[model samples]
Target: MITTKDLQHLFALIAADIAAHRDHLCELDGAIGDGDHGLAMDAGCEASVKAVAALDPAQATPAAAFNTAAKAFLNAVGASSGPLYATAFMRAGAAVKDRPDLSDEEFLRAFAAMAAGIQERGKAEPGEKTMVDAWKPAADAALDAWASGASLLECFDLAERAARQGCEATRDMTAAKGRASRLGERVIGHIDPGAASAAIIIASIAKFVEQHDSCRIDM
Candidate 1:
């Protein structure tokens, strides 16, 4: 089961990871974007984690934490990623509304919902050299692993792996959406900053699950 505490920890890990990779993400964006992707992601994640952390664990549900994070992220980031990730967290909150904790299945559903929300909000698909390349594959991998009777940790591990691969694959893809789209073939050979950040987010989830031995769920 994943409690609000776990969700809070997850966001904290995400914020830390994003901050640590800020320079790398900015460099990637410099290849095809305005080079502010890292700064936006770092600020948004940091704000989200802080907002969630301020919640009282005794009263905060997982959904509430997600909602709080969503609002903070949106308010902190003025870039396109702001709305996209805010929508993702909102959908994740909706997926487990009213729940104080989440079962493995509920967690998977929320994860998938986040990806779906990102796709819907951004109107981007795989091969678009965008975050969807990472998010969609991570969600799919989680679902597939869960369906195969994997533990929550295993499922998230697979998700992280898929997200990383998707991020790497973006290096070979031409931008088909966002400002990078205007670059045409010039964007190829460089990984998408959005995809890189998405991978970091997914990996944070996996890392949190791994560190917590109680994160397992019955299949």
Candidate 2:
């Protein structure tokens, strides 16, 4: 089971991983964006982990932790990614509302909800060269792997692979959304910064599950 403490740790791990890749993320954004994605993401993750860390794990439910993270991330990052990630965390909270702790499957459901929320909030499709390219396929792969009776670790592994593939696919796609869209064919050779960041986030999640998972047995 994943307690509030576990969620806090997960958030911290995510922050650390994102921090490590900050420069690369910014470099990716420089091609077609304002080139501050790395900064915004780092700040938001830091705020989110700090907020989650402040919660009393013994008293806080998973929902409360996720909700707190949502508010903190949104407040810290007023950029376009802010609302998207805020919604994602909010949806994750709602998915497991009132749960004292999360089972592996419950955590997986919350993750899927995050992807759904981002897709809905951004109104972007899979081929739009947005974060949806990574998030959607990753979520789908995780759910599918779980449904197929894979272990939690295996499911996350598949999700990370899917996210990476989706991120790479964006390099061949013309941007259909965001500022990059205005560039048309010029955006085709470059991966979307949002997709790149999304892939990083998914990779972090997969790593977290692999390292701390208690549900390694096949379902």
Candidate 1 C-alpha lDDT tens digits along 1-219:
789988888898999999999999999999899999999999999999999999998899999998999999999999999999999999999999999899878988999999999999999989989999999999999998888899888999899999999999999999988899998898889999999999999998888878775534333
Would you list the C-alpha lDDT of every candidate in the order shown?
Answer: 0.93, 0.93
> Could you tell me the lDDT of residue 15 within candidate 2?
96
Could you tell me which residue pairs clash in candidate 2? none
**Candidate 2: where are CA atoms >4 Å away?**
214-219
Per-model TM-score on C-alpha atoms: 0.96, 0.96
Q: Give residue 204's lDDT in candidate 1 (0 to 100).
A: 89
Q: Candidate 1, which ten residues in sequence have the lowest lDDT sum?
A: 210-219
lDDT of 1: 0.93
